[model samples]
Target chain A: MTEHVEAKSATLADELLGVVQAVEGVSAVYPAQPLWQSVAGAAVAAVTGEQLPLISLTEQDGTLAIKARIGVGSPLPAPKVAREAAAAIRRHLGNVPAVVEVLVAKIEA
Target chain B: MKTPGDALECGHSLAELSAYLDTGEIADPAHLDSCPECQAGLASLRRLSELGNELLTADVAEAGSGGDDWMQTILDNLRLELRPGRSIPLRAEDPQDTLWETEGSVSALIRSVADSFPGTAAGKCRLLGDITEPGAGITVDVEIAVVYGHAMEERAAALRNELAKMLQVQTELDIQAINITVTDVLELPAPAMTPNTEDQP
Candidate 1:
C-alpha cells in the first residue's frame, strides 16, 4: 500500500511537470522555486487560509512570469495574468533572468 | 433518494428534460405529465439551479472587497518588481562595469507598492527620456485603479506622496517629476447582512 501511494504521488508530480512544459514560450518549468514557493504561498494564503495549489514561475530574458489556467476568462481586454505574474517575479528578483509561472491544475470538484 | 443533480428516470430520459429546459423544445411534451420520474427530475433540477445561485452568492461574499485586508496582505507579500523597460547606463569608476536597470523592473515595483495601499492599485507605468545616459531628465508616469468608495482626489494625493517617497528611497534614477492617473474604479462589495423582518411567528 505504501509503495502504491508513492507511485501515485510521483505520477501526479510528473503530470504537473508535463502541463508546465506544454505552455508557450516556456523554456523551463520545474518544481517550485524557493523564493516563489514561500512568497506566492503567503500571497495565496491571504485569500484562502488553506494551502494553495502548486504554482510554477518562469523567466524570459530577465523577465519573470506566472502561468495559471483558472478557467474564468472574462470577455474584456485587461492585463494578462501571465504577464502580471512575470512582473511579480521581476519585482522580487530585481532584473534577474527568471520567470514565475503559476499553474492552477485542479479545483475542488 | 433524490440528490440535487440526480435526474428522475420515470421511464423517460434526463437528456430530453435538460433540452426542454434550455430550448422549450422537447420531442414528446405529452409524456411529461403522469410520469412521476420526469416530474421529480424537473423539480430536482430546479432546486439545484436555485442552490447553485446561492452558492455563487456565497463565493462572491467570501472573495471579499478591495478594502479588505486579505487583498492588502497579498499585495504586501508580493513585493512586486519594477518594470524597467530599457537599461540606462551611468558612468562608473571602471569602464568595464555597467550600471543600469530595466524599465520593467521599476514599473513592477511601483505597481506592487501602490497595490499595497487600501482601495488603490497600480496599472501601466512609463519612464520618459533616455535613462541609459547619465544626468538625463527622467519623468515617472503611472496609472492606478482605485476602489469606488474612496475619494478619487484623496486616493491620488496619497498615492503621489507614497510613490515619491518610495522612488526616492529605492531607486537612483534621475526622476524630474512623478505623474499619477486614476484609470479605473473597482466595485465595492455588498454589505454583509441584509435585513430580514419575518421572525414574528
Candidate 2:
C-alpha cells in the first residue's frame, strides 16, 4: 500500500513538472500562500466586486504574453485600461508590437 | 444643513431626511412616516442599490472564464513584453564591449518555468535585491493561479525544482530564494461559447 501511494505521488509530481517545464519562459511553479489569497482576494473584490483577475505571464514564440480579465463598471467606459495594459506589454517585449497583443477574457457569471 | 423648501412647507428638512436615510439617525423619526418626500427619496436609493447589484452580476458574467474564448481573444490581443528590469552583465565576446541580459529576461525565464505546468498559471512577478548591479543577490517572487482540482503541493514542488535548474543555468543573480504564492484558484467553466460569443454569433 505504501509503495502504491509513493508511486502515485511520484507520477503526479512528474506530470506537474512536465507541465511547468513546457511553459516557454517559466523557471518554476509553487503553491500560493494563505496570506496572498486574502490580500489579492480583497483587492480584487474591492475593484470589481467579482472574482479577482487571473494574472499570468508566459512566452509564446520567444515573446512575452500576459493574460488577465479587466473588470469594467456598468455603463461601460471606453477601455482605457485595455490600452494601458497593451502599452505595458509592449514595454515588456522591448517595444515590440509584433510580439505582443493584449487579450481580455471576460469571466462568465 | 437644512434646505429651505422642505423646512418651510413641512417643518422637515430633505437634508435631514437624506442624512437619516444614510445613517438611520433622525431627530424626529416618526415624522418621516407622514412625509411622503422622505419615503420617496429612500425608495429611490434602495432601487438604485438593487440595480447596482444586477449590473455587477451582469458584468462578471461578461468577464468570462480564464479558459473561455473571451480570455482567449484578449490573450491573443495582448502581446506582453518581457520585464527586464535590470542589466545583468554577461561575458562579453569582445574585451571592450559589454555583454548583458536584462532582469526582465531572467524573470521571463522564471515565468516560463512556472507556466510549463498544466492547470497552473502565473501572475504578477517581482525580483528582490538590486538587480542593477552585477552579481547582486536576487530573490524571485511570483504569483500564480491554479485551476480548481489540481494538486497544488505536487505542482509547486515540480515548479521549484524546474526553476532552480533553469535559473542556475541562465542568470548570475545570487539566488536567495523563489517564493511562489497561489493567489487564486480559478473555477473555469466547461468550454463553450460564452453568452457574449453566442450573442455575436
Candidate 3:
C-alpha cells in the first residue's frame, strides 16, 4: 500500500509537470530535486520500470507538496511565468488539494 | 565533430562552443540551431566570450599583448559553474502554492538588460541578501566593462535604473540598491564586416 501510494504521488507530480510545461513563457523544465534524490529515484525507477519525474513530490504534514524548477523565455517577466505555471498546476489539482512550488531556474533569452 | 563536452549531459560543452565561436568549425552547423542545449550553451558562452574580449582588449591596449593565462583561467572557472543560484520566493495565488525564481536566471535577465546599453558588457552578477526569505531587502551587485570612449558613469547609472525596474517587474525583492562596478576599460573590437577577411574555417 505504501509503495502504491508513493508511485501514484510521483505520477501525479509528473502529470503536473507536463501541465506546467504547456503554460506560456516556460521554455524548459529542470530537475528540482537534489542530486542525491535524483540518483535514488533513477535507481528505484530502474527496478520498478517507472519513468521518474524531474520534479519532486513529498508528503509534508499530510499535504501533498510538489516542487518544480523551470526556465522562462525572454520578453515575459519570470515572475509572470512562474505564477502562470503554478496556477496551471493548481487548476489541474482541482478538488484534490496540493501545494505546488514552481521555481524559475533559468531565463533563456 | 563529436567533441566530448562537459559531462556529455547534452552532448555539448562551453569549451566546444567556445571553439566553434572562435574557429567557425562545428561538424554540424545545423545542430547548433536545432539543439536547445547547444543554443543555451552558445548564448552563455557568447556573452562570456564578449567579456573575455573586453579584458583581453584592455590588456592589449594598455601594455602590449594579452599573453597571460588569465583569460583561459576565467573561462575554465566559468565553464565549471553555471549555477542556478538562490531561489528567491514570489507571491503565489494561494498560501499553499509557491512561486520563486533563481538568482542565476535573474542575473541572465540583468545581463540582457545591461547589453541594451551601448558599449557595455556585463560580467559577474550577484544578489547580496537572504533571497530565500520573502520581501528581503536585496542588493544587486553587477560588474561591467565599457569601451574606452563611452561614458562609464552615464552607462552604469542607466543600467542601474533599468535593472531596478526590471527586478521589480520580475521579482518582489525590496528596493535596496543596484551597484554597478566598472571593471575595465575595453578597446573596441574590429568590425564584423571583416570576418571574411580572416582565414576561413
Candidate 4:
C-alpha cells in the first residue's frame, strides 16, 4: 500500500523572500509587483488589513523560479553583488532546482 | 488589425509613439493630433505606462521602508567600498602626515542634505568639473524625487540653498552651480480606514 502526504504551499515564497533579504550586499529587494496584484492587494487590504510581499515566484517546468529587484550599494560592483545574491537564494532553497535572477535597480550611496 | 510593435498604415511605429510620449518631440507633432493611427498607438502606450506605475507602487510598498530588516540585512552584507574620488587636502596636525577629503564624500553630503527634507528622496548625484585641483570650479548636479503634494520649485530652491551651506561648511571646493532635477514625483499611500460607525448603526 502507498500513502500520500500533502504539504501546504502558502508560505514557501514568503520564506524564500526572507532568506534572500538576509543575504549580504543587497541594499533593497526589488518588489516585482504586478499591476493586477496591486489592484487586488488594495481591495483585499481594505477588508483584511494586510499588505503583500515584493518577491515573486513562478513554477516553470516543475522547477521554482525566483525574480528579485535589488539595490546595490555604491562602490560595490553591481554585477558581482547580483551574482552573489542569486547564489545565496539557491543555497537557501536546497535541492529545489530553483532558478534565481537578481536585478540591480539602483546603486545607493 | 494592429498588433503591438507593428507599424501603422501611415508608416509610423508604436516605438515612435512611445518615444513621443517620453520626449514630446516627435517629427510631426501637429499630425499626431489628427492621425488615427498615432492616437491609437498613444492610447495603448499610455495604458501600459499606467500599469507599469501601478506595479512599481505595489513593489515599493512590499519592499517596506528603508529601516526594515530586509534592507538592513542587504546593507550589512554590502560592505561597500569608500568612493574616494579626487583628493582635497586638509590642514594636517603633523607636518609629515597628509589629510584630505574624498569627492565621493561630498556627493554623499549632497544626498544627505536632500534626503533631510520632508517628502523628498535623492537619486543620482554628480560633481562636475575638475576636483583634483585645489579651489577648482565644480558644479553639483543632483536628481531627486518629491512626494506628491509638495511644491517642486520651493523644495528645489530650499534643497539648493541648504546644500550650498553644507558644502561650504564641510569642504573648500569652489562650487559654481547647483542644478536640481526633479526626476520623479511619488504618490503618498492611501490612509488606513477605521470601521464606519454609521454603517454599524
Candidate 5:
C-alpha cells in the first residue's frame, strides 16, 4: 500500500532565499521582489512611488536561475563567500537544474 | 537579420548613446540632438533605468533593515578578513608595544559620518594619499546619493565639515581635502498614513 502525500505549493524563489541565507559567510540575503510588488510599484509610479529583495529567481527553458546580492561580513573575502553561497544554493535545490549567481553587494564591518 | 550591435537607421547604436550618457562625450553631440532615433533610444534607456531603481528599492525594502535576521545570517557566514591598509602609528603607553589604526577603519568612519546626515546615503569612499606615513596628506573622496528637494550644495558642505571635524578628533592624519560627489538624486517615498478609525458609528 502506497501512502499519498501532498506536494507543497509555493515559489521556489522564497525557499532558495531562505536556503542561501543559512549559508555561512553570507551577511544578508537580498529579498526577492514579488510580482504583486511590481504591479503595485507600477501603480504607485503612476501617482508617486519608490524599492531590495536581494535575491531574484527566474525560470527559462525549464532551467531555474538564481541571482543573489548579499552583504559580506567585515574581513571575509567576498569572492570566496560568493562561491560558497552558490554551492550552498545548488545543494539546497537538489535535483533541480539551476544556475546560481551570487554578488557581494555590501561588506559590513 | 539585424545583429545585436547593429546601428539604428540614424547610424547611431544604442551602445554609443549609453556611453554618451555616462561620459557626455559623444562623437557628434549636435547630430545626437537632431536625430529622432537617438532621442527615442535615450528615452527608452532612461525609462529602463528608472524601473531598475524602483525594483531595487522594492527589493531592499523586502530584505528588511541591516539589523534584521536575514542580514544577521549573512553577516554570520561572512568571516570578513580585516583590511588593515596603511596603518598610522599611535603613541603607545608602552614604547615596546606598537599601535595603529587601519585605513579601512578610516573609510568606515567617513561612511558613518556621511550616513549620519538625514536624506543621504554613502557609497564608495576612498582615502587618497600615503596613509601609512604619519601626518600624510590625505584626501577624502566620497560618493553619495541624496534625496530629491534637499540643497545639494549645503549638504556637501555640511558633510565635508562634519568629516573634517570627525577626522581631526579621531585621527592624526593631515586631511588635505574632502571631495563629495553627488552621484544620484533619489526620489523620496510617500509617507505611510494610518487609516482613520473614528468614523465608525
Candidate 6:
C-alpha cells in the first residue's frame, strides 16, 4: 500500500477507535490484530514514520475491514456493548462499504 | 517476567504490569487505564494474586510456615498467557458486521459473581461447548472455595442460581448447566496435619 493509503487508513482507524472508546461500556481498547501484524506494523511505522493505530484497518478486495478489540465494564453486558460499538462504527462509516468487527476481549472486574 | 516474550502487544511487559499491581505505579497510568492489554493483564494478575494468597495461606497453615517450595512452584507455574480465551458469537444487525465476546470475559463475569459472596472465592471457570456458535448448548463449570464456616451446600446452591441468572442476562449461550464445584474449604487456621505414618516407613 502507498503511504497515502496507509496514512488514510491509520487516520480512519484512529477515528473509529475514538468512537469505540466513547461508547458507554467500553473501558479499554486493545490492539486487535495478530502479534505478527503488530510487530510488523510497528516496524513499518518506524521506517515510514507514520502513526499506527491499535485498531486494525486493512483493505481487502476493495472493502475496508476494520477490527476493534475492547474491554467492557459493569452496568452493561458484553453483547450489548459489542453491538453498540459496531453500530456506532457503522453509523460513522455511513455510505462507505466496509466490514466492521468488534471483539469484547476483556470483561472488567 | 522470566521470558523475552513477556511483553504485551502495547509494548508493556508483564513485569511492569506486576509492578503496577504492587506499587500502583506505571510509566503512564493513563495509558494503563485506556489500554485493553494492560487492563486484561492487571485483571489476570489480580486474580492470580488472590489465588496465590489463598495458596500461601494454605501452605503456611500446613507447613507451619510458608518458607517452602510451594511458592516457588506457583511462580514456576506462572506461565501467564493473555486471556483472550474462546470467542463466542454475538448477534449482529448488519450482515457484514461481526461481533463476539471472549470466553475470558465471561469467565471473569462469572468469577466476579462468585467472589461477591461473603465467604467465597472463585477458582477456575470453563465454558465447555462450541461457544463460537450462536445459541450453542454450553455447560459452565466453575470451581470455587468457601470459608470453613459457610455451609457448602447452601453456598453452591445460591451460586448456581446466581450464575444461571447472570449468564442468562449477560450471554446468548444456551446454558445447559451451571456446575459449581466446591473444590476447597478454607479454614482460617488449617487443621493440624497428622504426622505421615507412611513417611516413617
**Candidate 4 chain A weakest lDDT stretch, 10 residues:** A1-10
**Cα lDDT tens digits for candidate 1, B72-115:** 33222222221113654433332322333334435544655565
Question: Residues A1-109, candidate 6, lDDT per residue (tens digit)?
Answer: 9999877887898899899999999987876864435677668756896545768888888888889988887668778989999999989889888998998877754
* Most lDDT-accurate candidate: 6
Worst 10 residues of 6 chain B by lDDT: B72-81
Highest DockQ, which number? 6
Query: Candidate 4 on B98-131: residue-level lDDT in tens?
Result: 3344454455456556766765656667788877
Please give the TM-score of chain B in predicted model 4: 0.52
Flag regions of model 6 displaced more than 4 Å: A34-37, A42-51, B1-20, B23-38, B44-82, B190-201
* Number of the top-ranking candidate, with TM-score as the measure: 6
With candidate 3 superimposed using the best TM-score fit, by how many Å does residue A88's alpha carbon deviate from the native?
A: 1.5
Candidate 6, B1-201: lDDT as tens digits: 345556654677778888989998888676665455456557656765775576566553343323433333322223223445677899998999899887767776776778778656666677888988887789988877665668999999999999898888777889999898876665556566999999895
lDDT for B21 in candidate 4 is 93
TM-score of 2: 0.36
Question: Candidate 5 chain B — worst ten consecutive residues by lDDT sum?
Answer: B73-82
> Per-residue CA lDDT of candidate 4, range A43-98, in tens?
88557855455566666687776766555554454445556666666777777876
Please list the Cα RMSD from the true structure of every candidate, rounded to 1 decimal place: 20.6, 27.2, 8.1, 21.6, 21.7, 5.5
Q: Candidate 3, residues B97-197: lDDT per residue as tens digits? A: 77877666676677667755665666666788898998778888887756667888888888888888788777788969889987666554444474575
Comparing candidate 1 with candidate 5, which one achieves the higher DockQ? 1
- Model 1, residue B13: distance off in Å is 44
lDDT of 2 by residue, B58-78 (tens): 443233243344223212211
What's the C-alpha lDDT at position B80 in model 4? 19
DockQ of each: 0.04, 0.01, 0.46, 0.01, 0.01, 0.51
What TM-score does the predicted chain A of each candidate obtain versus native chain A?
0.31, 0.32, 0.79, 0.72, 0.67, 0.84
